[model samples]
Target: MASTAGIITPEWELPAGVQARLTTRAGGISQAPYDGFNLATHVGDNRTSVLANRRSLLRQLVGVRSVQWLTQVHSNWVVQAYGGAVVPVADAATTEQRGLACAVLTADCLPVLFCRDDGRQVAAAHAGWRGLADGILLHTLQQFPDPKRVLVYLAPCIGPSAFEVGPEVKAAFGWASGDCFIAGAGDRWLGNLQRLAAEQLLASGVRSISANTDCTVMNSERYFSYRRDGDSGRQASLIWIES
Candidate 1:
């Protein structure tokens, strides 16, 4: 794990040469509610600031490949990421092309990262319950040949206890053969986003896995959470090739 300092952000290189990094709330420039380093343009944030923040990140990672961002729709559609014209309505993005980075933005939704040990390929998926239940993880896994060659990392999001859901959410996963949920407060249920993702990754053949201890709801000072804030900023979790 590399320190996300001085604009390089936190870049983590697995034994296989695959590298990743997650942005912090401390960097960049945005306003209140979206203050500090907020990175989403669709969340009612100032476009100028969002662009500047993105520019700052690009400047910091100069000489490396440009970051390939996606327009996510909380769906299960995964697309090949080659710095080409980004497809509309895609929820997950993957890449075998180096230099160009793969990134996903989220406030409360899970930002899942995937990579083959050889470091030749990497991917990022934005998975809210809607996408997760739709088999986004499973779909993303199809891009990689060996699940064991892949590694998984979950980003900050609403915690299970904080993630309250209705029958639809439960039934969606239930129909997918997922058994990670349990009954909870009122008519709601507690869904473990990390566990569900982990099981799905393992089911897809991932041999190595790690889940972030960070929770967007709990670590508001460190990340942005939509569940905690009715409308708030977004944090980006990304992976790129090392120059």
Candidate 2:
């Protein structure tokens, strides 16, 4: 529930030992387009700048021992994370170890953070439309003991008004997705990514949910949106059990 210059601490009533933060596109040294606080290493930002930004983020994390970063393939795959140099090729990561942070990178795609009510475990998922419809959140939740005992935080993403998609995109979620999409231009639908995510979480028995409703596409000063700008940098959402 706290916000600093470039970091947003999600407003969820997690256990005392669980901590989470999402980075905004501010307070970094990268140049235009990539601009400030871009965290993705594969997004064409300068190597040195990206490394420096990561170090700055680590410093802000206080006692975090290490952060597990994923390759994020837009798939439903979830992996057990241990903070180390080897990056796994998965969309979501979970960890029960204290001081080890799990993180996901995104621009317009949704980033969902999860933590158990008892503060024993934490997870992060990169939930782009492809991954979300494929059940990335559910896969991540499977790493926990029970869905009902987990709290979820949906990060800022491209909002409904800006997320126009073809009918085939809506078909991915089947009949339940119908309410999450509104008619857009001819043959197009304005999809509600957050709503879809929330509905899915609810269906999975997760009742404790909160979100950052800021639209990445609309809020140019605070976020990076791939749909708004073709080539863009990425922000990160991270969760961990504090030591």
Scored by lDDT, the top model is 2
Q: How well is each residue in 106-183 modelled by candidate 1, as lDDT tens digits?
A: 888999888888787888999998899889988998889887888788877788778888877887876344456778
Q: Write the residue-wise lDDT of candidate 2 on 1-243 in tens digits.
A: 688979998888888878899999999998888999999899888989999999999999965988899998999999999877999999999988899999999999999999889899899999988999899998988888899999999989999989999989998988465679999879999999999999999999998999998899999999999999988889999999987
TM-scores of all candidate predictions against the true structure: 0.90, 0.98
Residue 110 C-alpha lDDT in model 1: 90
Off by over 4 Å in 1: 1-13, 84-87, 175-179
- Lowest-scoring 10 consecutive residues by lDDT in candidate 1? 4-13
Candidate 1 — number of clashing residue pairs? 5
Global CA lDDT computed for model 2: 0.91
**Model 1 steric clash pairs:** 4-9, 4-10, 31-35, 65-99, 147-205
lDDT of 2 at 182: 94
TM-score, cand. 2 vs. native: 0.98
